[model samples]
Target: MTARSTQNKRKRFDPVLLLVLLLIVFLTGLLVQVILATDYLGSGLGDDVARFQDLSGVESPVTAVLLNFRGYDTLLEVMVLLMAVVGVWSLTRAPFPKKPIEPGPIQLAVVRLLAPLMVLFSFYLVWQGSHLAGGAFQGGAVLGGACVLMLVSELPWLKNISSRFLRIGLLSGPLVFLGVAILCIVLQGTLLDYPQEWVGTLLLLIETACAVSIGLTLACLFAGGRPKDDLSGGRKR
Candidate 1:
């Protein structure tokens, strides 16, 4: 009976494995078809973007597309980051170290030096984004890296950060973006359609706010939960 059971089990193919194999084969065929239908010599939308690039308020085509041409998509992406942090906070409390560990002099020195510099560099990236390859996401990533460095060093001040401040930082990006969109609708009867004269300023404003929020959101995600003050019933464990 045991031998029969083993044989039957061995003979049964895994449905999941079969499904995965089918999917792989389908995708491979689709990829081949797409490759065969490729237009390698196409200029694509470069000319269209260039023709309107001056009106985008930023010299970088990528930035113009991300923050101006398709601002709604960027708005949704920022909201997604905020929602991710909210979901994480809802699920668990930040796993902060109960007992703070003192860092070595070298580690402390490095963090102190690099954290500030990284912050400055992040802002520079935000500024450069207007005319170059840098932008809010890159700047925010750098800022988040700096925060992670401080967290790893177990900075006492970081633990004491007010929940209100954190919440404000996390919400600022989406709120500002939504506000701009609504304002555009009110003024121009279209969402995110900045006035020609104000396009540059508005894009900058959005990028700055988004960079700050993205930085905070990323840091909060790294912390893995809500700050103590944000806990229910004002409880702290």
Candidate 2:
């Protein structure tokens, strides 16, 4: 009976289950530790940002921080996004619908009307970033949504869009950003240190370029991979 009971215990043992339980316990303890260490009353960098907002050139403190004070971080973020899309493209081809469904007239009309308005609104958001809450990411999101709408509507032009143009759009933001940084180094002996007179202009340029790239990036991600035209050397498969 003793031997039989030991054999049953061995049969019931699961290393994977034990590991999962241990992981859950470890995570719970870490969460508790984080809770204990929380400082709810700690003041953040809002005051410092406001103190130097004028020097930063943009009317919006958030824009000043993102495009000016912490520009390096923003640069890395854009590169990361580009790398993500590149990685996705390398791993898989875009799985566009094989049987192209004829979109209804109403759907087509809605998309045609909305797409142009969205494009206009996206730039408007970019323009607002300097003085208001909207910025590149928000504008880019709107633009991406517009692309998605057109794609779903099966716009013929989108199917034939050249990979070359896509590549240019994807690279525009980071290239412009890095170019500006290099130019700043030449002019001011520091990376991204814009001349006072050029600060506003430089910020707008960066925002515009970044918005375009970001929109393309998001749209490409939604498409899930490289276009079929790119894979087939610009010929329809």
Candidate 3:
């Protein structure tokens, strides 16, 4: 076709694109108007705060809302993250490199110094969540950061860890959370309904398991595939 004819043909297709753009703009304007008209924000916060102390049984309002008032939300979120990791695992398993990359001396020094601190900080965050802003997700992220550091530094012991153990580590959190949920149903006749007296202890157990599981899952994701089993003789000791 001639250049001018080609340009005309392209213009013919432009109307469909223009209609989509106009539709998107109209939807955006409608959404904005709805948001502007809503008067629930302040009232909602006040309501949540007023009932927080009694409803949550925890000092931290955020924790109370997440792990108690809306515990199922957190459970589903954890399951979603686990599902994502499972999907990644099913895609492809990359071969372990013959010679692992070694971090420089400064990198090694920093990792050695920082890894322990990160672990300690992660636990502190998880423990503090009952009365503070930190929680299992934040603590798990910190722990994952520590694992990344260890992986990059090529720590001998870390490299030698068996794949089965790694899989268990990645799965521990979800398993524990699911188990607790089932136990609640069996013991309390409702999902996640802990007895008032046992709330704190049960919460602590769930958070600790979740934190460790999240940490390992995140670290395995960073490594990009399931680790090779040391016993399989795929990797040299």
Candidate 4:
């Protein structure tokens, strides 16, 4: 019986299929490298600099690439973040921690002082992304850190906040991105393509919305679950 069981387990291990898959992956990678080495004619690097210059009204080439030239990529990245938060929500039942962790006075005080500073810096980072080395993701991380701080401190207001607002905050990025993509398709004949004249305004708006949504989503992720509303509990001092 033991020998039969071992044979059954061995039957489940498809070594041939595994080897075939490995060989296919290796060949695919090798093909790509060979094409790249031969200087593929369709490569984007050749005209990227010229395209970057012609994309009107945008100061940052990086931003232009992310939000304009390859917007679908950015849109997909935002969707990934949204999906992560959604997956977390789906798997979790108990919103918020069962036992509240009480932070000490110094920790609470530090969070109080640092939260606003981080928020201000995050905004700067988001705004500067158009001209320099910051963007929505960086700003969102700072903002998310602030939210995490608030949660870690177990602030009264945070604990008592409405779930409805939380849900809105979490879903805000994906919804806005999807709406913008659809609107672009209607007006520009392609997804995420902005009108030449309105490139700055539209991209800025999208980035701002994305930053906010990313912030909320990340905070929720750190919390490990959704927050529940407690209308009856008054704010603590």
Candidate 5:
């Protein structure tokens, strides 16, 4: 039986198929690298990597590539976030049954002390993301973790997080991505291809919106309850 189970698991993985896929991916990567190295993408975006070249403190070419050259990937990333919100919402639909599980006082106290700080930290990450490494996804996940902690404590105040806001927060990034893409087409004759005049401002604007929406949507999901119409029993303070 043990040998049979091991063989079944091995069959499921199909190492030969995985190796073939890996080989294909490697070949594709090699092709892209060669293309970029040859300046086939124009001027080697890496030229802008230096602080002297990007005096405004951003790696302009990198930002441009993300929002323009590789914009399809960014759009798909936004879509993934949208789907996550939709999936979670569908999974925890109406008639939210109370599971009768209450946190112990000790746990509740810990949550009360920790949740707000975590949320604040998430905002910090969002705010610093423009020129720094962190961004909306990282910050939002942190905020969501805080919301889950608060929800676990069954605190009513925390439960009053607005449902309308939740929906907006969940959809904001994708909406902005779509909006910007459309605007770029209107202005530049190509989708997501921002005008050179507006590149810096546009990147900042999109990043901010993505951060806030990511934070709010994820937090709402973590909170689990439908965004409140009334906090009858969930009041925080």
Candidate 6:
């Protein structure tokens, strides 16, 4: 009876176990750092960190490092998000009738006006991503917000999106990125290495495509849809 009880007992939260796991992760990464010793002075305003004055003479290292040096980490982040979509689909039976998420009056009015401007702003940011502050991920996030606003409205705008289309949207970002990477490898010596004059153009194109796909993904997530009606004719109710 005692053996059976122990076997059937629920696993309790163990802080010691959590700490040991974290220690293992830190130690593994620390060993890699010790072996490589390779770093950019990208550490910020925190303690023992170099300031902008210290980092002078270098061009916009943040932007360059993000898109170039840290590209793999960013790529993995996108993958994690893609996986979340699959997890959600598997966990929930979607296209169940939805109630609008609903917003307060002032919030609703603000979102109504800001939505279009935000989209334009996101595009501008993505355009600048190749050189300046933003990139495909940031642009996609803003586009996602626009879709959220629509879903939260008293009148939903996405009444016709099929789940199949949503599945497409979810996969689009990775597929496009993979295609570009493969193309670059075939045409050039490296994957996703921008050719002459093609750097900004390619980045902008990818960002634009990502923004729309993100919007669609957000819309589908919020709508829970394989919607039945024509949503193209959507108007405020």
Candidate of highest TM-score:
1
Tens-place lDDT per residue, model 4, 56-173, is: 4567777777777778889899999988887876655325555677778899889989999999988888899888878788889999999888877887667566778877876777
User: Which residue pairs in candidate 6 have backbone atoms (N, alpha carbon, C) closer than 3 angstroms, thus clashing?
Assistant: none
List model 5 lDDT by residue over 1-35, tens digit each: 12233546445555676789899999999999997
* Candidate topping lDDT: 1
**Poorest lDDT segment (10 consecutive residues) of candidate 5:** 51-60
* Candidate 3 lDDT, 1-237, residue by residue in tens: 222434565444455677898999999999999999988756776566656567556778887777888889999988888887787666545344667776688988999899999999999999999898988989999999999888877775665577778778777877888888898999899999877777887887888889998998888788776555533544333
Residue pairs with backbone atoms closer than 3 Å in model 5 (clashes)? 156-234, 156-235, 157-234, 157-235, 157-236
Find the number of clashing residue pairs for candidate 4: 0
Task: Return the number of clashes found in candidate 1.
Answer: 0
Provide TM-scores for the models.
0.90, 0.87, 0.84, 0.74, 0.62, 0.60
Off by over 4 Å in 5: 1-57, 60-69, 94-113, 158-162, 220-237
User: What TM-score number comes out for model 6?
Assistant: 0.60
For model 1, what is the error of residue 15's alpha carbon versus the real structure, in angstroms, after optimal superposition?
Answer: 6.1
What candidate 3 gets wrong by more than 4 Å, as runs, is 1-15, 94-96, 156-159, 230-237
Pairs in clash, predicted candidate 2? none
* Candidate 2 overall lDDT versus native: 0.89
lDDT score of model 5?
0.66
Report RMSD (Å) for each prediction in the order shown.
3.3, 4.5, 4.2, 6.3, 7.8, 8.7
- Model 2 ranges with Cα > 4 A deviation: 1-15, 231-237
Better of 1 and 2 by lDDT: 1
- The per-model lDDT (C-alpha) reads 0.91, 0.89, 0.80, 0.77, 0.66, 0.61
